[model samples]
Target: MYNPNELLTRFRKYLQAEQLAKSTVEQYCCMTKYFLNYHKCGADRISTSQIISYLVTISSPVSRKQARAAIAKLYFMLGNHQKMNKVPAHVGFYAG
Candidate 1:
C-alpha cells in the first residue's frame, strides 16, 4: 500500500493538474486527510460505504457536500472509477 503522505501529495498534484481552484484543492486535500485519519487505513482499503458513512457524520450540509466531493475526487485520483461512481450525488441523499 502506498504511504498516506505520498498518496496525499499525489492527490494534491492530481487536483492541481485538473486546474481546480486553490481553495477547492486545499479543501479537498484537507477533507481527504481527515477521511484517511478517520478510517485509519490506506485509501485503497476505503469502501464506498465507508465514504458514505463518513459523509453522513458531517451534520452540516455544506460540509457534508464538500466531504462527499473530496472523497469522490480521491477515488478518481486513485483510478477507482467504480467507487467514484458510487459516491452520493447530493448532500440530501444517502448512498443506499
Candidate 2:
C-alpha cells in the first residue's frame, strides 16, 4: 500500500542524500514518477519484465537509457536488490 507521492518524496530525498546533481535528481524523479504512474502499481510489486516493457516504449535511446537508470536507482532505494540487478544494461542499438 505505498502512496506514490510519498514514495516519490522519499526518493527525491534519497537521491539528494546520494549527492546526485540537482538536474540528475530531478530527471530521475520525473522518470520514476512516470514509471510508477504507467504501471499504477505499488513500487514493491514492480517486476523486471514490467520495467523492460516500459523501457521498450520509450522511442529515444537516450531517454530510454535515462529511464532505465532512474528505475534501477528507484529499486535500489527501495532495497529491492534483486529487481535492481535485473534491470538490463543499455543496448547500443536502437531501431527507432
TM-score of 2: 0.66
| Candidate 2 error regions (>4 Å) | 41-62, 83-96
lDDT of each: 0.65, 0.65
Report the C-alpha lDDT of model 2 over 1-96, residue by residue, as the tens digit. 457787889999999999999988987887766666665543434556566567556523435567777877877777666635443332111211
- Model 2 clash number: 0
Total backbone collisions for each predicted model: 0, 0
Clash-forming residue pairs, model 1:
none
**Per-residue CA lDDT of candidate 1, range 1-96, in tens?**
556687789899999999999988987887766666655533434556666567557523436567777787887666666645343332121111
